[model samples]
Target: MAKTLEFAYETPQEVKVGDDETTFTLVCKNEGLPVDLTTAKLITVKIGSRDGYLREQPISIDSLSKLPTGQFKFNFDKDTLDNFPTGSYFLEVWVADDQGTSIYPSGNPLNFIVTANIENSSGATITTIAYDDFVKELNKAASTIVKGDKGDKGDKGDKGDKGDKGDTGATGIQGPKGDKGDKGDTGTTGPQGPQGATGPTGPKADKGDKGDTGTVDNAGLISAPAFHSLQTQVNNSAVGTNLITNSNFSSGLDHWKVNPGANSDCKAVVTTDSDGDTCIHITGTGDACGLYFGPVSFNQNQVTTASVLAKGIGTIWWIGLQSRPFSNFGTISTESYSKIGSIMQADSSSDTFCVYFNPVNNVVDIYIKFAKLELGSHATDWCPNSAEILTQSDYAKIKAAIVALGGSLS
Candidate 1:
């Protein structure tokens, strides 16, 4: 396939692992001339190893230089280097504009080398201690010191300044021909007074008649009917209700079946993505092939929905139903994990669900994750089967609750 943009870099150079000062420069070109990057919305470098995409770092638009030539410079900082061991790596520069995203140097990914750091290769042994441990050791050493003589007391602090005096009150209302009396000094507290004699006790009254006894229903225990109802509700909860077994493919291909056409090179396997997330990686060329889910059950006119995160192009289809030949989600192509879904009302025909890729005769490369199938018309987030999520202890507690409520598990 022809790429819209081209990227040329300084002659392939090797950088020592952990070398932060070294920089790598790439010049983006349209046709053979340098492209003006000022108008571009985003420029990013996707770094990866032979395994897959590891990380992406954005290049600031201000950093684009057009002086002698248009280019951007980046370095292998600690964070990016930490994800890489001493080995070969590749990167692709992505340039985006109002048109769309364009990947550069489409021929082959730009390659670079990472060699082992000198310190690592030297095999030097360095001993280190935790700060807390070092502090403890210093305290242990200080314990052997002799006691010092007591110091003399410090001088007392000076007295604080006195507060200002209050203003005199206004003259009292004029009295009617009366002279004012002198104020008397405060009197001393008086002695405690003697206790008074107790009064005579009152006569007791007769007790009232006892009340009637109340009826006890079930002795305050849970009734069998209520317990059964609770048991039914607990069973109906979403816990063990996901219809797609091996939804995440974390269990390899336990519940999945491969349907490869004659002479088809298609196959699916469980693999981890760049972020260490589990997904199904499907790759093949030539004839069409697919990954199928079930001849599982479904009811007439029941709304069933299925969804899966995918990259590349493919279609999810429902077969073995009364709906003509089959029903399928519209064709979808994506460069990243995108959720694709299909909704259908079932007929009594069959319940087989298949995800078709590579169709007829074409190349197929895609990834799938977190597939889900449920009864609602709307697709929901992926969830594992109850056996994968419910722990034995949790189930035990639930069982005990049911038993205590006078219910029995079938």
Candidate 2:
């Protein structure tokens, strides 16, 4: 008996583009007597478009002599559908006798779809119909073409009329001016304005009248006393009496006297005569008697009563022997009186005592007097001719001396 063969077209239902090529199996099963099918040289596979026209080329499964259990597979190159558009195509498998002389009815025809609509690749298509039902639904009358819903229509409107022409009325009189507007708000300050031009010179003013002179004071012009006046209250006291009385050394002597001895030593003696009148008598001669009155205490070896008496007598005779005048007498020295150290006689009588005058005090009145000739030989021309005699030069010297003594001579 002849062998009966069964076949199937096996390809994936869905595949992506550019994947490995698909394999279609043309399965054959041996159901009758064993046949030497190894002699068959070719098994044919026919692919067609969905329109039912056969493809111009057919793929052959070769090497059937090595076919086992009557099964065969053919792997078509993936480039087979490179130029085809994305759509469904068809595959058909058939077989023929090894001699190519007759068709075999032993293998039933098998069908598959060549789907260019890749599963997930770009440009692939998605349809609601199942892949198996695609060809049937594509042929259905009402389902073949799909239409989208239509959009709504727009409304219409009426046309506008032309505007009326304006009237040409007489020109009315000009309206009254409007009320003044409110002041505008201040804006941001601008740059400072330029400096203003200089103003014109003004006319010269009249001279003002002179003012009255103020009253003049004569006190400054008057001389300050050589000695301050003894206060009237102090003068009335016993202290004042003691100061004046102790200053006097002799009652017969009306004023203090200075008599310097030849040895340059001196003595200052006070004498109260029987009449209770007082006097100061000095005896001796030298420079030691130059300073007669001062705050200094006398040492017994340096100062004697005679030297003090000579200086006191010299001062008194020159200035009328006023107590206040002699108060500052210590400033006199041999340098100031060297020209007139000898006692000066006021008269030609040899019995007359020699004396000195305070030339600065106008040389008036007797200031000091020596006793009779027993007193000593007078140092030549040492005395003034009279109590009132004073040269202009002597007055000047005395004035300067008072000033040197810190007394105001003015």
Candidate 3:
């Protein structure tokens, strides 16, 4: 089996979902004559579920070029890699160098899996698998059940007879009787004992002597701190409290800008809501279009909750943080007034913590409002901005207020 065309994945035995690209390095192993460029026909790399490998040769690659060091590189697109589902996959490399093309092994097919990135949760939902994946799994499992040699027949054993009943044992003293059972349910009163002759009227008893007034003395005691029970006030102001600038779109599209790839047709404008609210409306015709607000101060490695309210036409739009699309919460379908959100690990690859949107298509207008990006793994209520909430003066004011009120908060 000259199936010995050696190749190795850059990250052996594992591939992540969101990786921009993955590569397989092919080391020339064909010892055939005329090893130079002219005789080197092509080296193909084909992948299939481990099950599919049992039935076919590798798919043909259009061509393979050699590096100065005689190593050929195979690059796989991760964006579209999701076309294959989660599970093991078999990667086969066959060379048609001057020697000859590789042939199948008589016993087992050569294969391995490009496993789902179980540890990298950022790309949790990308999916693809063979049409008969379940069936293949079942067959693969069944074929692994090799039977062991049979055990020697066991020796027969003898039986024993039953014993006779034993004599009764002597009685022990009885326990004290249990408390008498509750009085039996009362019997109905007998018909007013046949009206006995009326008894003479008894004289009314004299009023009892007045009872003495009772008195008790109270003593000192420790008491728990009294809770004021003041209700937490709601901050209904949507002017400027949010960490995101122009998040409410009240400043129109001031803080928002087009990402690098936007064309002139892909532009944003402030539009009035059908219910009379203001929002940033994006419309255009391009393979991709987007609006982003960011470069805000935030640290990656910490998880955060990001969200936005979107309404308009189209199957879906992206929502989440982005540092050059390095991370996304996935897509949200804008079939209605969708309030989309996700919790993500801040992608530290870039410092930009952006609220981004990319419509599925540009045929219709897309409306977005209240884009919020904040630290923490869970979303809190939409607390709008209030007077430069992050300023030193405001911070001091807030701390002073808390301290003045005798709050224990640090």
Best by TM-score: 1
lDDT per residue (tens digit) for residues 59-150 in model 1: 88887654334567778767667556776567788989999987875545655567667565346643345556555554554454445444
Q: Which model is ahead, 1 or 3, in terms of TM-score? A: 1
Candidates 1 and 3 compared by lDDT, better number: 1
lDDT of each: 0.59, 0.34, 0.48
- Quick one: best lDDT, which candidate? 1
Per-residue lDDT of model 3, residues 32-151, tens digit only: 111233344665556656356422233234333334333455555554455555444454555566677653221122323344565444545544444375455445444544454444
In candidate 3, which residue ranges exceed 4 Å CA deviation?
Answer: 1-242, 260-263, 315-318, 324-335, 347-349, 355-364, 386-410
Question: Tens digits of per-residue lDDT for model 2 on 118-234?
Answer: 343455565343444543433443332344444444333333443444444454355456886665455544444444444444454444444443332333222212111222223
lDDT of 1 at 290: 56
Worst 10 residues of 1 by lDDT: 3-12
1 or 2, greater by lDDT: 1
Model 1: which residue pairs collide?
none
Per-candidate RMSD, Å: 25.7, 76.0, 27.8
- Candidate 1, 95: how far from true, in Å? 35
